[model samples]
Target chain A: MPAETTRAANRERLAARRAAEAAARAQAERRRRTVLGGVVAAVAVLVALVAVIVVQTHRTSTSANAAVPANTVDGTVISVGSADAPVTVDLYEDFQCPNCKAFEDASGRTVAQLVADGTVQAHYHGMAFLDTSANGRYSTRALNAAAVVVATAGPGAFQAFHDLLFANQPVEGGSGLTDAQLVQYATQAGAAGSSVEHDIRNLTYGDWVKTATDQASKDGVTATPTVFVDGHKLADLSSAGLTSAVTAAAAG
Target chain B: MRWNAATAGPWLGTAARLVLGGVFVVAGALKVPDPGAAVRAVRAYRLLPESLVAPVAFGLPVIEIAVGLALLLGVFVRTASIAAAVLLVVFLVGVGSAWARGLRIDCGCFGNGGEVTAGETAYPLEVLRDAALVVVALLLARWPASRLALGGRSVAGTTDRKEYSRAR
Candidate 1:
């Protein structure tokens, strides 16, 4: 009888020990989970706060730098209309941008009409956001070469080169324009001799391109085909909107 | 009964992380070249009130880069995966909304000037891709594949067995 009683006591002791271990484990797990939750919440809050600070900094910088004029930078000139026209429309474009091409195709004729009538003057600055990407085929080399062609060959050559580049934009994200292709486009634009080729090969006007791009950035211009009519930026560039902005600029 | 954890290897998780990270890196890099175009794309969404557009546009690429870096390094795997999944879903919704409204603007996923057609059909494909990513994320949330990660390898491996049993 004592042996059986001792056996029962041993079994109860084991049971109690096991229960205590299980409870301790459960408590530890709960503590771990609570600590993890707190850490995650703290990390999330930190990330959110950092994001807010960075955003505010960007906003402040952009607004602070917004006062710079778009056209004050000196660069290789690429003009589509008469230089002496009463109204000047400054265009910042990227060759890889479809909308810029669309704007050119859609409004090219109207713009030409206005230019020819001596009602408006359009100056284009080839910016290269698109060419930096795999999708930016023509905009890369063609834009650079066009700048040199304009610098070496003159405004007429620039206009002709611009038209050809737009007309012959390659498939998006394809291999960009080759040197031969650039020479071909430049030749078509009436640039002859080793001078134009040298200028392009040496990237002589590269500084001007960089300066133009930096100026655009300082002026808060972010997209291609950003048109500044006279000194005022247009709110939108839909066909009607552009026409109205141009008219207002001309009137002003 | 023995508990069976999902037997899929870590390759899928690794591949998903790499691909998603690559996509954001490229997207962010493209925008850094032309912030104005980025701002324009944000405006085209018309989702934010006008006041918020510039702020979101300027900072989104930086956020993308940070998330992409975290994902690629496999640090904070669960949190980064969840954030990435949520971001893709939001983008999918924005794309869908724009397409439905017949806006012929670019998706601007990569950057400004690389606009895709706003065809309504593309939205579904984008959403489907994001949904697949979310499933991958859930898997990561479960298995945590954190052996290769920076923050929680030991803890994850230890907890994984218990979680796997409980789940079963």
Candidate 2:
């Protein structure tokens, strides 16, 4: 009888030990899960906060101290050609982008003809996202210079300067045209003035260039030489293609 | 120490941790400075709804950096690995979808990803790279013990025995 009682007591002790071990294991598991949950929660909060700050700062910086050129409609678009033309053409281009130059070369004459005939009103949006490619923020400098020409000398000088800049676009990853060269180009384009000279040299419109590029991106114009006819994106960017698209839009 | 499984397991984890963590950090850093380009890259995929594009583009880089730092510092290795694996799987799907759709777009894995010329897309390579990273991430999740971890106990020592056994 005594032996049996001892055996029963030993079994009870063993069961109690096992129960305590299970409880401890459960507690550890819970703590681990809590820590893991905490990690995820912390990451989510950090991401949200940082993303908001980034987007907010970008917006404020773009608009702060930004200069607006004359004949500009949407802060980014510089309108040229007839105000009441039958067709509206939006040309999104980057000063340092080789592709924009190629596009301009291929279709510049056709666009000029349309403008001359009062058939189309052209809106140019100069972008500066290629600042990294140019050695000295050339994309922004060139864009800012063009803006200065437009602001001081009018859209006519701006058009001439635009053509000249594309005509002599620097190679990618090189320092873009010098400030003196930009002033000379402005003069040749009939944009010569002390104000034009000073603005071009100092990048008075640099903030505007950044704002314009950001706006272009917001408007879904990420790539250079993106064309739109009467709010419709032109799939074929060739001269012939553009002519036909413009004619069709005018007719429609 | 002689080269053996016991000696190598933690070191191997450390190496994987650094390589994968470094990749995440660099990719995130490149994209962070250019949200417009990032948004454009996401748009090029044409998979997400218009409403979700901005949010995803803006948030993804930050997530990558956070997870990368966690892995790099060896803090919360298991949880961070799971997060990394999730991100890799998402990338795999995105690249795979773009490939299937015949869209000529860069995977935008690093930065400046947008519409490329028809000849510029490297969909297969992108998918392969993401798949491999996914494997590494999952492996890290399975065995979070690494030589340079910052938990209460040194993972490379006997302290991680319980975790290793539990993982097994």
Among all candidates shown, the one with the greatest DockQ: 2
Docking verdict class for candidate 2: incorrect
Q: TM-score (0 to 1) of chain B, per candidate?
A: 0.75, 0.89
- My TM-score estimates for the predictions, one after another, are 0.55, 0.77
RMSD of each: 7.9, 5.4
lDDT of 2 by residue, B57-97 (tens): 77788788878887898777888899999999989998888
Stretches of candidate 2 exceeding 4 Å from the true structure: A1-61, B1-9, B33-59, B93-108, B112-125, B152-168
In model 1, the clashing pairs are A135-A173, A222-B36, A222-B37, A223-B36, A223-B37
On TM-score, the candidate that comes out on top is: 2
Whole-model Cα lDDT per candidate?
Answer: 0.65, 0.81
Clashing pairs in 2: none
- DockQ, all models: 0.14, 0.21
B1-168 in candidate 1: lDDT tens per residue? 333343334445666667766776777767765655676677776678767876677777776776676667766667767777778778878878877886445667877632342112355666676677667666765655632444433333343655543432
Q: Evaluate candidate 1 and give its CAPRI docking class based on DockQ.
A: incorrect
Model 1 gets an lDDT of 0.65
Ten contiguous residues minimizing lDDT sum, candidate 1 chain A: A64-73
Compare the candidates by lDDT and give the number of the best one: 2
